[model samples]
Target: MLWLSCVDETAPALPAAWLIATDAQPANLPERSALRRSLACKVLARQFGLPDAAVEIGHEPAGRPLILAPQGSGLHLSLATRSGLVAIALAPRPVGVDVEQVAPASEPPLAMLHPEERRWLASLPASARPETFAQLWSAKEAYVKALGIGFARAPESFAVRLDGAGRFVVDGARNGGPASGFVRLTKNGGHESMAAAFIVLDQA
Candidate 1:
């Protein structure tokens, strides 16, 4: 099973969430996003009956979080955040999640697309750029994260292309298959007027 969640920034993490995050001293929003993501994993472990000390979150050489416990600890996790929401994804295999605020369309979507992808995006009506780019960016980020590699891999190296069937497909394979992707959109606030949030989930 794959599990994902979004939590408000003001909420404190569960007490046990601190065990593996004692060294963090977050001083900014981005830093807090990183810390909250780790704590979320601790909370998940505790929910599964693992003691505070029994479950620790550690990072691979590439900075992907991995469960550190007994050899059989059956949890795998990943996370990301946008504006005010922190998103988490858990599974029994490598997984990754990312959340991005969609309202303001922070950056130029064309800059992030692969050469081929850029052509496709250009063909769409100008009005559809933001939403489409949001999905592309989120899907690309999640794929890299799930591979346990960070930005060392260029977002453009692999493309999120489409088949004659018109379904999304990654350009290449990893871990014996293409990483699976999912995206969920939520309202920015109580209002439906602006950029909302998108949670991208990817798994091996």
Candidate 2:
């Protein structure tokens, strides 16, 4: 029961999720990427025949995603947003997702990378920095967000290295845990977005 969605940033036809953003002040909020993420889940609820108003979405203290109320028995979901594209995934188990615009990362994101990561960033040509960093950043962010720990763990705690084009390896050994994952980048709204998920283990 995994579901994923990509919304056109410039979609002339607005979907239901955008309403979550619209309720806020007109000029104060950043229109495009700054919207709250649960909007995507709200859209999914509608698609699943549930009332969007009944859904309860909250965040962990660490800023990781959370489900405040018990989700319906049949589904669990994850979402990612970048530039103007939004991706949503639904499955029968816990899930996590992240989307970062692939451009020059703001200073904050770069600062989150460890010295090792900085070295890796420095190794790449100036022109290649954004793409390389974004790919690796999104992957790890997705993973941690999946774990629901967020910044509680340092980004460098896990080791991520990219070799061949479209190939990535993540090693969490340094993070004191054996968690890791892979990702493939796709073009969304003319920006690079990476999506990753773990195959849910069926306990039943």
TM-score of each: 0.68, 0.60
Question: Residue by residue across 2-74, what tens digits does model 1's lDDT show?
Answer: 2223322222222111112132445686686666655665565546555556666677787777666644656
Query: Taking the tens digit of each residue's C-alpha lDDT, what string does model 2 give over 1-204?
Result: 222343222222211112111223223334532454556546655655566666665555665445554464455545555554555544454445555555644443556786777887887787778767776776676566556566577886766766554445556533344444445555554434433333221221
Model 1, TM vs. native: 0.68
lDDT of each: 0.54, 0.51
- What is the number of residue pairs that collide in model 2? 4
- Give the C-alpha lDDT of model 1: 0.54
Q: Which residue ranges in model 1 land beyond 4 Å of their true spot?
A: 1-30, 50-54, 69-71, 103-107, 162-168, 188-204
Please list the residue runs of candidate 2 whose C-alpha ends up more than 4 Å from where it truly belongs after superposition: 1-3, 6-38, 46-56, 60-62, 67-70, 74-76, 104-111, 163-167, 173-177, 186-204
